[model samples]
Target: MSQNDGTGQKPQPGKKAPSGKTLARRQARTLAMQALYSWHMAGQSLNEIEAQFRVDNDFAAVDGAYFHEILHGVPRQKTEIDGAFESLLDRPLEEIDPVELSILRLSTYELKNRIDIPYRVVINEGIELAKVFGATDGHKFVNGVLDKLAPRLRADEVRANKR
Candidate 1:
């Protein structure tokens, strides 16, 4: 059986250790998901949710600025983000799990607004977030939705990567 490192990361023989910047971004995503879930489920204001995250979570190590952007940006663009997922999804966004919806919104935000980041990277991050925080089978759903979204959002990059 494969062993997990103390941090719950499995040792993959060929996988390189994530760089410091990458780890910080991952943590930022994690925090952003939590903040969004709160907003989606409780109907909290964006400023309130962000302020709560700053007080409740340890932010000294994460990308605080990135977290700020995601937490605010997703809600600021919620109508557009949810509308994008709405077209891709079989049901309304209100039917989605708050956790999964939060992750999706973040991925949607990255795909539409942050083209500097690769589409594959956004999907991988969304899948990871869903696996850790969403329902048991949520990662598969996340994978499916994001897989469909990637080509539409990043056609050139997807076609390039296919080769």
Candidate 2:
């Protein structure tokens, strides 16, 4: 038996419930990932996708601005974001699973544009997103790619952490 961590839900076996801010940010990432997947599959305009998501999902606990930023930013910067870590991929982008690709693109965007977030947090979040939305082993693949991409994009931060 487990106790409710005061969130009206049982905490996972070894994990505490995320703080409100963390939960909001995580919900933002999740919504962004889903929106990205829809955009990739349907070829819809990002604006349409954003508007639809706003209507379809509960945004009350999500960081709406962060979700909006990622949904729009990733596509707007697709070329540069893809180029940033394309060389590190073991396979071509098309060969990669869309779920993994979206997770990668989303995380890579943060690594490149959101300097407020730490590289390790970006990488870890990507892995977590994969575990939830990706293939059985997709988290491993996401980890491998982000692990390589982080040092390249966050060289100073990575090096500082290493010392």
All candidates: TM-score: 0.92, 0.91
Per-residue lDDT over 1-163 for candidate 1, one digit per residue giving the tens place of the 0 to 100 score: 7665423687578886677787788889999999888888899888888888889988877889999899989988989887776788867777888899889999999999999888999999999899899899999999999999888888899999999
Model 2 agreement with the true structure over 6-67: per-residue lDDT tens digits: 33557687787768887788889999999999999999999999999999998899999999
Q: Pick the candidate with the highest lDDT.
A: 2
Global CA lDDT computed for model 1 = 0.88
The residue-level lDDT of candidate 1 at 157 comes to 92
lDDT, residue 106, model 2: 99
> Which ten residues in a row are the worst by lDDT in model 2?
1-10
The best candidate in terms of TM-score: 1
